[model samples]
Structure formats: C-alpha cells, structure tokens
Target: MPKDPANNICQTHIFEGIYNKYSKGLHDFLYYKYGVQTNPKDKTQEAFIKLWDNCKNVTLAKAKSFLFTVANNMVLNEIKHQKVVLNYQKKPQRTYTNETPEFLLEETQFLEKYKIALANLSEEQRVAFLLNKVEGKKHSDIAEQLGVTNKVVEYRIYTAFSKLKAELENFNIK
Candidate 1:
C-alpha cells in the first residue's frame, strides 16, 4: 500500500509529544528494571524511536504500554547477550610471585569454583544479590528502586543467600 506522508508527519508529532511527556518516567522504569544506567538510556531511546516509527498504528492511550514492552524486551535481549559473552570470556587469574605455589593453586581453584556457583543462580536472585551486597542497597531501598514490595525484595535476598550458601558449603571460606 502507498504511504501517507501527511499521516506520517502527524504521527511523528504525536510521538514527539509522547516522548517529551514520558521520557523521564520511561528512563526511570528501565533503570529500575535493569539495575543499570547506560543500557536503560539506550533502551529508552530505542523505545522512543520505535514508537516514532510505528506511531501511526498506535494510539496515545496505549503508547506508554508499547514503550514499556519495547524497552523491557530490549533489556532482556541485552542481558541475554551479556550472559553469553560472559560465559565465553576467559577467566583471568592474577599471579603473585611472593605467594607459595600451593597457595596460588588453591586460590585459583577457589575463585573458579565461586564463579561457577554464582553462575548457577537465577537471574532475579543474582540481580538481587548484586544490588544488595555489591551495590550496598537496603532491602527497602531495593524494593522501591525495583518497583517491588519490600517483602518480595527480602524474600529474594534470602533465597539468593540460601542458594549461595548451599553451593559454597564445601569451600569452608565463609
């Protein structure tokens, strides 16, 4: 079918208006969902561009949902790609000349074991653990930041800890 230039221009205006109104909210939503900043911005920008490209088919009332769906899918795809890259990356071990050979071998083994254990965790558990432990975010803060209930955040943390503890039980490194 032939395209309508006037309709396209009108749709572009509508999409621009929507983007101006909701860009901040969309960015925040993406950040909270992904626990990252740069990717969230990229996803938000991509979502807006998608909306602009498909504006003629979308109504104003459904624009927010469409943007969110696009952003969520983008984040998921990025995460999956990152996981694949991480899995294929070679592990880099640090060498210390001062350390005894036995100590160095044990340390390398322990590090590799820990990495394998961590990789076994569920995505939500891993994310919760990183946000709470690595990022030093409180459960309540993480809950609010992630748009979940505080109790759910606590549960996720507990689940993550239990799984990690079970996986590392043989190491006795605490």
Candidate 2:
C-alpha cells in the first residue's frame, strides 16, 4: 500500500527530533573520521539534509545508523574528490638552506622515508592509524565510525604502527 503524505510528515518530524539530539555527536564523529581538511561541518549538514529528505524511508530505530552511514559515504566521497584534485596539482620543488646542512639533509631524508612507509600501509590500517594517532580518537569511537569491531580497529592500528616502526627503525629522530 502507498504511504500517506501525513505519515511522511510525521516521520520527518521524528527524524528531525532525533537529529537535534544527535547532530553534535554526529558532527564530532565525522570530524574525527575525516579531519579538518575534508570540512566535516559542511558534510555533516549535508548528511542531515539527506536524512531529512529520506526520513520517510528511515525508521526511528535505524535513524542513528543511517545518519552515520550517510555521513561516512559523504566523507569518503570528499576524500576521493580531494585526492583527484591533489594528484592533478603541480608538485612544487622544495629548496633547502645551507645554514644547517646536516640537520636539513636528515630531515628531508626522514620525511621521504616516512612518506614511503605510509604509502606501504593498507587503506584501512592507514585510516585507523591516522584516526587514532593523529586525530586522537578512541578505539571504540573509531570502530563505531568505521562500522567495525573495536578489536579490528585495534588490530589495524597496531599493524600500522608496527609497519611504520619497522620502516623507520634506522632513522634517529631524537
């Protein structure tokens, strides 16, 4: 049977109520997941607008999960778009000063090696590492945002760290 417009309105109202209660948390979740470069606020707003538009199709009990899933998809899309933009941009040559030749050379080499090590990580491991180490997200939160179990998140983070540490073993950063 076709649903009534009035019923849709009621569902939307309920979704809005749920959104009002959870928007801040959702925004924080996105920010932690994607970081500042991806513009979490705009993405969060867009996600909720999508939710409001599809409110009739989403049940109250499922609204939270739906909002998170929608928001994550938006973030992933933004990341992919940004990656394309970055790949097309011209690479600038870095110039080094001679005042501290030893320090500068070491720093440059370390950065190059670090980049290579990071590139070696799997996408999930890389994301987990950045979210935990750089963004300071708890394992539970990372798991929730990524739709994975906490144990899995922990394993990814550990694997990333192990790879980085192994790759960077020769570097004396101190």
lDDT of 2: 0.82
> What value does the lDDT take at residue 155 in candidate 1?
89
Q: Enumerate residue pairs that collide in model 2.
A: none
Clashing pairs in 1: none
Q: What is the lDDT, from 0 to 100, of the residue 52 in candidate 1?
A: 78
Worst 10 residues of 2 by lDDT: 3-12
Q: Which lDDT tens digits does candidate 1 get at residues 24-111? A: 9999988886677447888889998898777777667778898999889988888898888888775665555788989989888878
Model 2, residue 42: C-alpha shift (Å): 1.1
TM-score of 1: 0.44
Model 1 misplaced regions, further than 4 Å: 1-10, 90-174
23-128: candidate 2 lDDT, tens digit per residue: 9998999888778887888878888888788877766667789888989998898789888889877576566665687887888998899999989999999999
Using alpha carbons, what is the TM-score of model 2? 0.45
Query: Cα miss at 77, model 1 (Å)?
Result: 0.4
| Best by the lDDT measure | 2
